[model samples]
Structure formats: structure tokens, C-alpha cells
Target chain A: MNLYLGVDIGSVSSNFILLDQNGRLYRKLYLRTLGNPVKALKDGYASISDGLDKQHGKIRAVGSTGSGRHLAAVLLGADVVKNEITAHAVAASHLFPGAKTIIEIGGQDSKIIILRNNIVHDFAMNTVCAAGTGSFLDQQSARLNIPIQEFGDYAVKSGHPVRIAGRCGVFAESDMIHKQQMGFPVEDIIMGLCEALVRNYLNNVGKGKKIEEPVVFQGGVAANRGLAKAFEKILGLKINVPAHYEVMGAIGAAILAREQMELSHSPTRFRGDNFVLEGNFTSNSHECSGCPNLCEVVCIKRDNEVLAYWGDRCKKWESSIKQPRDRLKVV
Target chain B: MSRVGIPRSLFYYYYYPLWKSFFADLGAEILTSAPSNRHTVERGIELAVDETCFPIKVYLGHVAELCREELDYIFVPRLVSVEARSYICPKFMGLPDMVRALIKETPPLIDITVDLSCDEKCFQKDIIRVGRLFTRQARKIQLAYQHGCEELRLCRSLASQGFTMEEAIKMWEGEPMEAESETDLNIGVLGHGYSLYDERISMNLVKRLRAMNCKVLLPEHLGSEVVEAEAATVPKRVFWTLGRKMLGSALHMSQREDVDGIIYLACFGCGPDSLIGEIIERKVRDNKPFILLTVDEHSGEAGIITRLEAFCDMLRRRRNYRSESKLSPYGASLHSFENTV
Candidate 1:
């Protein structure tokens, strides 16, 4: 079988997906980024390789997305690189062709994508505020001494969800503490927090955006049934969560890779499974004193040869590596 | 000869040459605060009011920098209006006072109220008023004003002909002109001149768009008459000069078939932009693809670049598909996935 690989390295978590030529999911791995994406990528690849037998399929193409997309693409020789918005929108459209709106609440960021006929019509992402994200819930759940996976269960068991302030994280935390001191049930507080976050998401990220029917919710936060229930109730619409909710970005990237390869009719640049297992990777960065901008340039090396350099605003360093317009070769 | 300092912010982009020539003609040495950088923004954040927008904070930083230079007289004019029934922002109207309150031991300010709404004569009178501070001769002041006006006209012409403020200034100083190449995409960039032209403030937005093979059209490039004509179409007129220009240019661009899309660059926490951005968004929301990118000191480059790349990809794909299916009026249909759920 021919396979494709996609990796999404976000600030909070890293997700990986392996898809067959027929668009069938072969393996998925989700792990915490923990401020070390390079290590996370290596560990993810190790686990994915272990899951498949020795006679596993030939990896055809690879793609990467999220905040660390460039780093991942350079590291893995990805044929395609995309942003989280495109990756999410592509994945949502594939999962639900008729989806007009996508509510993606991830570990550290939340975004609302409006679509029309499978095209991304408009999008808005959370800025300067962490009032509506999974990380906020994770912090609250830890303080409440409940497992994050059980957060939605507690909300579901609530007989009456109380009103909690969610305009900002600090206010929400203090409000939750106040409510707890007043002896509100743990389930009620959890449900109230979920409702507040949903309301915040709608008011902020979904503000001024037309929320159409056939809405799809996907991300790590989609695992929380309580948030999904709150979203459905508030919007007065049914929300669809795909089976591979956590790894949708990776899946979308894989889909993008397939599309790119098919359009160009070029061979895949996949370095193979052994590339991650046996490759010796080292990285270094230096501030270029060439100009006043003082851009910090970073470069990756494989087996003592420079593969790629980025982070330069002027592209002076990046261009020198690809001066003659040659294809990226893996040593 | 006394030295005069000008804070390089806000209306500085529009009227700096006029002021520079006027000051030079008056025999005073002209000094300007440096272009905004990370240190400037940090200083502004430390000195400015918490509720003020990012640009205004940067302005305060410029003013503070001028204060440190100890110039004899700093020019902080109160720009009320350039046209009738339209006002500049309240911040511009009260800029001198704000600088006064923010900085102690500041140099004497050449604070003159310029209200051109009454008539064109007011502009001349305001110039004469500032010129009096340097010299008392009427003929000298008139000569300087004429020279200043001529230079201002040249600057405006160069700007409307698609030259950036920096490029126009360089050309004025006898710098060789660089050839402007044609590109496939015509993107209308609408924003305040300060924010749009300042590379550090906007994260080099125009350069990035150009690097992506887009021919950028700034609001200043579209003449004032064109902007005014388009602004009149809105139900309620935009009161702020820059706001009116941006909104008007956006409306004009939306109606044009050649302009692929509109990108509105706004500084975070700007009151006028918050309203103008919404109006422009509503006007062009259906007609063309509109991207409203808000920038602050805290915005990371990685996040911004990702959004920009995605937007560019979408535009490229749309343009390619439209051309491929030229026979169809609405173009070929994009594939939609089956609703598996």
C-alpha cells in the first residue's frame, strides 16, 4: 500500500496522521508538544512505526502544518506546508462536505471558519485573549482535582449549570473560586465553565460572522462532549465531530499533499521511516549582524550538512541555500 | 539658527515635506525623530495611556524621543480638518496637550490649529502663523510658503503616482528611481499612511505582498477626488480624514473588477479603525475577499505569515480556477467531500 504522512506541531500539542492512497486512515498519534517539537516529532514517528508491522506500506508523500510547520517541513522533507486554518478547513470539508461553519477550539487557540460550497469564505482567530481554549479548561480541571478527560462527564452530570464569568481568564478563575466557596456542586461549576467558554467563543471568535447550518467542530477540545452540547444548545444547531477529531489538521495536510502531488505529477519526497530513526539532526541559530534588522537566522543540519535556514526577514540566508533553484535532496 | 524637531508619526507622512521645506526656507535646522522600532514601541507603551491605540502610543514615543534630543521648538500642530464636515481623530486634535501631559520639561511647541474646513486661506494663514515664530518679514514668509506648497504638490504627485513615502522622499533628494514591475495580482492595501508605510509597525506588509507577486495599491495612490467621490456613496460619511480615505478607497476598489481583493491593516485598539474597518468589511464582504489584519506590538510574525500565506493560496487557487473555466460565467465547481457523519 502507498501511504502519506502529515504532522501538525502546535504550541500545546503535536498530532500525526498516516493515510493510505485511498484516503483511509492507517495510524494516528497525538502527543503534548511540551516546548520541544523536535523531540515530540521523533517520539511520534517512533510510536507510529511501532504500531505498523515490519512489512508496512511505502510512504509516498508528507505534509506539515501549525505554528511549527516550517521547522517540521524542513525536518521531515514535507512536500506541502499549510497553515492551521487551511488544514482545519480542508479536513472539515472532507469530513462534512456540507459544513458551512467550523468551530475549532484547540489547546491554546480557538478559531471560527465560515465556508461556502467547500471554499473558506471567512475566518477569525482568538487574539490577545485565552478566555476560550482547551488550556484554560486544563488549568481549571487541574485546580478542581478532576482528570481533563472527565471534565465533560462532570458537566454532563450537572443538574443545573450555574453562571460563571468568562470574559477573561483571571475573572473566570476568581469567579469559579467564588462559586466554589459558595458551595456549588463540582459538576455544576464545570458545566457553567463550559457554557461560559462557549459563550465567549461565540461572542469573540464568532463575532459578526454568519453561523450557517451543518456546523463541524473539531480539535482537541472536540473531545469534550460538554462543550459540544453547549455549542449545540447556544447555536440551536446540531454539531458534527469527526472520529479523528484530534488529528484533523494532520489529515487535512495529508489531503493537501495528495492534491499537490497529483497536480504536479511529481514523486514524493518522503525520507522514509528510517530517516527519523537513524538520522542525526542538529540545529543552531545566530543573529545576523549584516543589517539593523538583526534577524535571528536558524538552520537545520542533517549528517553534518546544512539542509535549510529560515527566520531571516530578508531571505538572505534562505536564498543562499537554494541559489540555483535545485530540488531539496536528503543526504 | 534654532533647531525644530518633528515627531515622525501620524500626519507626518502626509505633510512632512511641506513642513520640512517650510522650516528649511525659514533658515531653521530640521530634525525628525527616528523611524519606529521595538525600542520606540516599548518606550511608547511605558509612557502612553493604557487605553490609547498602538499608533498613538508610538507617536508618544516619538515625541518623547524628540524631547530627549532637546530641540528648540517641537512642531505639534492641532489638525482639525482638511475638508468641511470631516474631522481628524480627537487624538490628533489633542496631540499637543497629550504630549504636554506625558512629558515634563518639554521644549516650546509650535502648536497651531489648522482648520482648513473654513477655506484654503486658512492653510496659508496657519503656515504664516508658524513662519512668524522664525522670522517677521512678510515677503520671506510668503516666499517660504510658496516654496513649501510647490514641494508639497510634487510630493503629493509622486505619492499618488504609486511611489511610497520613503521612495518619494528619496526621489525628492535626487535619488535614482527604481523601476516598478507589473504583477499578476492587484491588491488594494487600505490603512493609515503611518501604519501602512512603517515597516516595523506593520511587519513589512507591503513588501511581503510584493514578494508574493502582488501589485499593491495604497489609499494615497488613489487621488483624493476619487476617494471623496466613493466616500459620498456611503449612507453616513466617515468623519475622520484617514478613515474616510481608507473606506472610500476600499469602496472604490470593491467596485473595480481588476482589484482582486482588499486588505485593511489596522493598529490594535484604534477607535476610528474599529468603526471604519467594520463599515469597509460590510461594504466589501460580499463583493470581494476582504482580509482585516490587526497588528500590535505583541503580534508574532509566525502567526501573521501563516494567515497571509493561507490567504494568498486561496486567492491564487480562486484566480487559477476562474481562468481555467473561462467558458463558464461563475467558473467550474470545486469538489465537496461527502458528509460521512
Candidate 2:
């Protein structure tokens, strides 16, 4: 069997997925990044490939997405490195053919993608604010001494949700504390928090856009049934959460990788499981005094052999590496 | 010869050619602050008040850069209105006062008030007053101002010919500029000239777009008549000069066939931009795709790169699907999934 691998190294979580030749999900793994994507990626890869032999399948190609996509591409020889928006849109459209809207709220960012005829017609991401994202929810849940998995259950039991300010995260937390001091039910407060986050996402990320039916909600936050229910209640439309909503970014990347491989008919750039598991990969950054820009250039190395360089505005350091594959040639 | 300093921010992108020409012709050597860099932004943030917009902070930094240099005078103009019925931003009107209040030590400022709201008579008088510092001859000052206007026309022409204002200004100063290469995408970019033209401030937005095989279209590319006509389509007239120009440019681009999409680069705390950006977004919402990118002191390149890449991907995919629809009888096909075996 031929398997394509997809990796998403986000701020809060790292996800890995494998797609078979027929574009079916073969294997998936989700792990906490814990502020270190490199360790998470290596550990996730090792766990997914453990006990798998050459007779089982060969890794054909690799794709990466999310905020750390460029870093992921450098670590793993990725055939395609796409932004989260494109990856999410592609995955949603592929799974739900009639999906016209996609609401993706990840660790630190939320986005609304409007699709028309299976192509992205318009999209908007939260600008300079992560107030209503998964990280905030996680912080609130942790402060309330409620397990994140059970946060939605608390919301579902609420009779009336109290209004909390959702414009800013700091204000929302204070408002939640205020509501708690006022002796409001904890369930009602949780449900109020969910409603407030939904309002923020719609007003900020989904502003001025017409969101139609067949809306597909994904990303790590999609696991929260409260958000899905809130979205359905507010938009007055059914929210469809796919079976693999948490790893949709990884799945989309895999689909894009498959498409790229088929289009180019090129050999797989996969470094293999041995290189990923055993290769000592390290990265370091230094401020380049080359002129007054003082760009902090970062260098990634694999066992002392420099793998890639970036962060310079002039591309002087980036171009120093002559490897053709290091350059992101998006078609 | 008198040495005059001009901080390269704000109106510098728009009026640098005229200032350089007028000062040079009046027998004064023109010295502009070094192009904005990390130190410039840092110093600007340190010296400027926190409430001011990013461009104003950068302008303060440029002034600080000039104060370090041995100079006769620094020209900080109080620009109220450039044309009739439209004013510049309110911050620009108080820029000279702000500089005086903020900078600890500085050369004597040749702060001239250029208000052409009703007529250019007062502006001409102020121009001669500034020129008198360099030369006493009134006839010589008039000729120099005329020469400056001629040079400004040449620079504006260069800008309309697909060069950035910075490049055009450099070209006007006899510097050689490389022409843009062939591009696959036509992206219409709108923003205030100060923020848009400064490479450091805009994070090399135009250069990045060009590297991505995009031909950038700016408001300078359109004639004033065209811009004014498009801007007049709004029910209420835009009172801000740059704001009006941006709205007109955005409206024009939304209807242009060659243009794929529009990107508005706005400073986070700009008052005029807050209103202008919202209006442009609503006006161009239905006609074409638009993305509002608000940049600030944060220098993280990841968010910018991701947004640009995704925006370009959206435009390309939409274009491909539209073109594919033309070829097939069964409407548009999913190009990415066609070869899935």
C-alpha cells in the first residue's frame, strides 16, 4: 500500500494523518505541542510508524500545514506546505461536497471560509486577536477546575446563560469571575462563555459574509459540542462536524500532497521513518547585523549539516542554501 | 549652501520629489533621513506618544534621525489640506507641533503651513518664505518652485508606470531602477502612501507580491480624474485626501477585469483608515474579493505570509475554476480531485 503523510504543527497541538492511495484515512495521531513542536512532531511520527514494516506500506509523500508549516516542511521533506485556510477549505470541501461554509477555530486563530461550488469564494481570519479561540477556552476551563473534555457537558446543562463580554479575552475572564461572584450557576456561566465566543467569531471573523447551509466546523475546537451547538443555535443552521474534525488540517495536507505527487509524477521526497526517528534535528537563530534591519535569521540543521535558512528580508541567508527542494514552489 | 533635512516619512513618499527639487534648486543640499529600519522604528516608538498612529511614530523616528545630523534646518510642514474640499489627516496638521513637543533638542524647524483648501496663494507665499532661508531672490524662488513641480510630474509618471513611489523618487534623483518582470497575477493594493511605500512598515508587501508573480496596481496608476469620478459615486464625499484616493482606487479595481483581488493595508490605530477600510470593504464586497491587512509594531512575518499565500491561492483557484468552466460543457470541475486514483 502507498500512504501519504500529513503533519500539522500548530501552536497548541500537533496532528499527523496518513491517507491511503484511495484518499481514505488510514492512521491519525494528535498530540500536545507544549510549546515545542519539534519534539511533538518526532514523537508523533515515531508512535504512528511504530510496528509498521515495509511490507505494510511505503510513505509516498508528505504535506504540512498550520502556523509552523514552514518549519515542518524543513524538518520533514514536504511536497507541499500550505496555509491553514487553504488546507481546511480543501479538506472540508473534499469530505462534504456540499459544504458552503467552514468555521475553523484552532489554538490561537479562528477563520471563516465561504466556499462556492467546492472552491473557496471568500475567507476571513481573526485580525490581531485570539480572544475566542481554543487556547482561551482551555485557559478558562483550567481556571474553573473543569476538565476541558467535560466543559461542553457543563454548558449543555445550563438553563439560562449569563451574558459575558467577548470583545477581548482579558475582559471575558474578568466578566466570568464577576458572574461567578454574583452566584450565577457554573453551568450557565460556561454556556454564556460559549455563546459569547460564538458571537465574537461571527462578528469578527464572519463579518459581512453570507454564511450558507451545509456548514462544516472543524479544527481542534470542533471537539467542543458546546461551540457546535452554539453555532447551530445562532446561525439557525445545522453544524456538521466530520468524524476526523480534529485532524482535518492534516487530512487536507495529505490530500494536497497526493494531488501534487500525481500532478508532477515525481519521486517521493519523504526522508523515511528512519531519518525522522533517528536524525538529530536542531535549530538556532541569531540577529544578523548585516545592515540596520537586524533580521533574526534562523538556521535549521540536521546533524551539523545545515538544512535550511530563513527570516532575512533580503533573502541573502535563505538563498545561500542551494538546495532546490528547500524553496517552496507552490503550484 | 545651506543644509536642509527632510524626514523620509508621511508626505515624503508623495512630495519628496518636489521638496528635493525645490531645495536643491534654491542652492541647499537636501538630506533625507536614512530609509526606515529597525533602529528607526524603535527610536520612533520610544520618542512618540503611544496614542499616535504607527506612521506618525515612524515620522518621529525620522525626525530623530535628522536631529542627529549637522543641519541648518529641518522642514516639518504643517499640511492641513492639499486640495479644495478635502483635508489631510488631522495628525499631519499637528505634526510640526508634535515634533517640537517631543524632540528634546533640534535645529530650527522651517515649519511651513501648506493649506491649499481654497486656493494656492497662501501656499506659494509659505513656499517663498521657506526658500528665502536658502536664497533672498524672489524670482529665483518662483522658478525653483516651478522646476520642483515639473520634477514632481516626472516622478508621478514613473509611479504610474508600475514603479513604487520610493523607486520613482529614486529615479527622479537620477538613480537607476529595474523594471518589473512578467507577472501572472494582477493584485490591486490600496493603503496610505506612507505605510504602503515604506518597506519596513509594509513588511516588503509589494516586493513579496512581485516575488509571488503578481503585478501590483496602486492608486498612482490611475489618473486623478478617474479616481475623483469613482470616489464621487459615494453618497457622501470623503473629506480625507488619502482616504478618498483609496476608496476610488478600490472601487475602480473591483470593476477591473485584469485585477484578480484587492488587499487593503491599514495601520491598526489610524482613525481615517478605520472608517475608510470599512467603507471600502462594504463597497467592494460583492464585486471582487478583498482582504483587510492591519499591520502594527509586531514584526512577526508568519501571519503576513500565511494570509498572502492563502489569498493568492484563493484567487488562483477561483480563476482556474472559472477558466475551466469555459472549456467544459459540464460547468466547472474540481481540478485538484480530477486525477485522484
Computed on C-alphas against the true complex, the DockQ of each candidate is 0.32, 0.49
What lDDT score goes with residue A141 in model 2? 95
What C-alpha lDDT, on a 0 to 100 scale, does residue B80 get in candidate 2?
97
lDDT of 1 by residue, B1-341 (tens): 98999988877878888888888999999999877765677788898989887888988888888888858999999889977877888888888898899888889999888887767787778778788989998789989878887998898788777777766766776787764587878889888888888777888888888876778888878878888999989888778888988888998999999888888998888889989998999889888888888898773787667667667656665576567642211112225222332
Candidate 2 lDDT tens digits, A191-231:
89999999999989999889999999999998888889889
Give each candidate's interface RMSD in Å: 6.5, 5.0
CAPRI band for model 2: acceptable
Residue B313 lDDT, candidate 1, scale 0-100: 59
Q: Report the poorest 10 consecutive residues by lDDT, candidate 2 chain B.
A: B326-335
Top-scoring candidate (TM-score): 2
Extract clashing residue pairs from model 2. none
**For residues B1-341, what per-residue lDDT tens digits would candidate 2 score against the true structure?**
78999999999999998888899999998899988988899999999999999999999999999999999999999999989988999999999899999998899998999888899998999988988898889999999989999989999999999889999998887899998898888999999999999998999999999887899999999998999999999999999999999999999999999999999999999999999999999999898889999999999878888889889988888887788653211112334353232
TM-score of chain B, candidates 1 onward in order: 0.91, 0.95
> Which pairs of residues have clashing backbones in candidate 1?
none
Best by DockQ: 2
